[model samples]
Target: MEIFKSDKIFDFMGKRLPFLALSALLFLGSLGIIFTKGLNFGIDFAGGTLVQVKYEQNAPIDDIRQILQAHPKFANASITEFGTPQEIVIRISGSSTELGNDIGDTVHTLLDPTGAFEVRRVDMVGPKVGDELREKGIMAMSLSLLVILAYVSFRFEWRFAVASILALIHDVTIAIGALALFQVDVNLDILAAILTIMGYSLNDTIIVFDRIREGINTSKESKLLLVINESVSRTLSRTTLTSLTTFFVVVTLFVFGGEIIHGFAFTMVVGIIVGTYSSIFVASSFLAQLKFSVNNYRAREAEKLKKQKEKEKMRAMYEKGTV
Candidate 1:
């Protein structure tokens, strides 16, 4: 069944040099930000006290912040509004043995003076747990990329694999960099977003690669550039439509998903846009440069080796027979 059709727009096949420069600039800038100011890990990554309090009525987040800050133990605490206005998520930095109880007691006094607010949950994570989580997050991301590379290489070619992986890296780095710049909390939720982005980005790259493969197989007399341009043009409608539909859903969540999923949805939106652009400008373009045919080259090499081996065997048989 036909899902969509391509509407030819100004060919985006030209001006490859400028696009490369812009992408490089973004990549290097993100790297620089990462080195200069590392990720702003939230409680999930840094191991801290998480306190969620539910009030009878909506509580003022700024007032809660002030209440936490009044105590020296909870100074510099992070506070976020969650769910209805009545709920607040408080993240207090790691406390020493002497001050942990005092910090909790102070928050209790401010919010539940007469049992107005109840402590929904109170959890303390050790620094070791945070370190382990950080390690695991990196491992998951690395393993995911390796798996994609191997699968793409096996299914298509190394050139396609490299381009797809690079695009994934680009999307992830930019997401992390934006987080650092804004001091966004790098937590398990954010990690989930990163992985989600990887999957979506890889899907987009695979679709484009599929089209490129089809073009090469079907068009016998088409030039490399023409084939690439056509492949991109043909798939452009489907890519844009799918991305747009997905983007609208993400935008809805971004607007209404509340504080809990805001960052996650935002990251997903960014990934969709970046993934689409890379599929066309990055993956297909790289494929053209490769100009390598896996099937043809392997078949030719195997044929040449087989012919040499047959000749060697025939000569050996003739010498033995004469002797």
Candidate 2:
């Protein structure tokens, strides 16, 4: 089950160039998506009305969409299956063209009574609120990154700090890109999910980083690279077990958490797997190129000891003179 055995430590050395080139390409692609396609902001950001409707019998989601789209006000309506075929969720843009209470009333008049239908929930978001929310989301994400960078750098070495944060940025960019390409909704819940993903991704990176630090600090016998390789190998079981457990939880949520939170669950699932990969290929790999000098570490320790001795000698001489 172990991929990185004693003999396999040098396996990646041959493919370093290829890996670097591919990583550069992926980074560039992510940057391009960020600047060009951008994020498809959800109702929470762009402001919109979300209407959840339930029916007694299974109904066509398309029929409900068609019904709403017929209205000029609800022309931009998008409908999706909520819980069951009988349940449908609708989204209408929140702008000057918003249908507001009129759309809800129309659904009640047009679709209710004739069949067993009821409005389960309705939420309206204003454009001003959406603008503020968009700004807040950006600020929160930026703050989280800054905090992670500082914490990781303080806790570990600068190389680890750089690699861990880079992996995080990589995961976030890839997640956002997937969202943009697939047109996933970027709502408040989804924003929460993205932030949660960042945290989750950082947790995975930190686990490996922690192991790397332990390997370096304790192992005078093994080479640095060998120590790291072993550290990753030893932690494989725990990593796999944790990831599988999380995967199942997310899958359950995606399957049964209802449509309202489905996007959030989906985002978590994607982030977890991406986080796992980045910890291995992305973060661990970077440690090999890290600027670590045993001489520097030894010199610092010697200097600290010398300073302590000098202070003690000075204190002893001062005490003797006083006596």
Candidate 1, poorest ten consecutive residues by summed lDDT: 1-10
Once fitted onto the true fold, the runs of candidate 1 whose alpha carbons sit more than 4 angstroms away are 1-10, 56-67, 70-72, 80-86, 95-106, 113-115, 289-323
Q: Least lDDT summed over 10 consecutive residues: which range in candidate 2?
A: 4-13
Error of 2 at 274 (Å): 1.0
TM-score of each: 0.80, 0.82
lDDT of 1 by residue, 1-323 (tens): 23445545334557566776777888789888988998888767788887888888777777777766877767867887776778888887664344565555667877554337877777677777888999999999999999999999998778888878888898788777777776777889989989998998899889887877777767553466666777788887778888889999999998999877888887788778777787778766666556756356455556978999999999998999953
lDDT at residue 12 of model 1 (Cα atoms): 52
Q: Count the backbone clashes (under 3 Å) in each candidate.
A: 0, 0
Off by over 4 Å in 2: 1-38, 60-66, 96-103, 221-223, 301-323
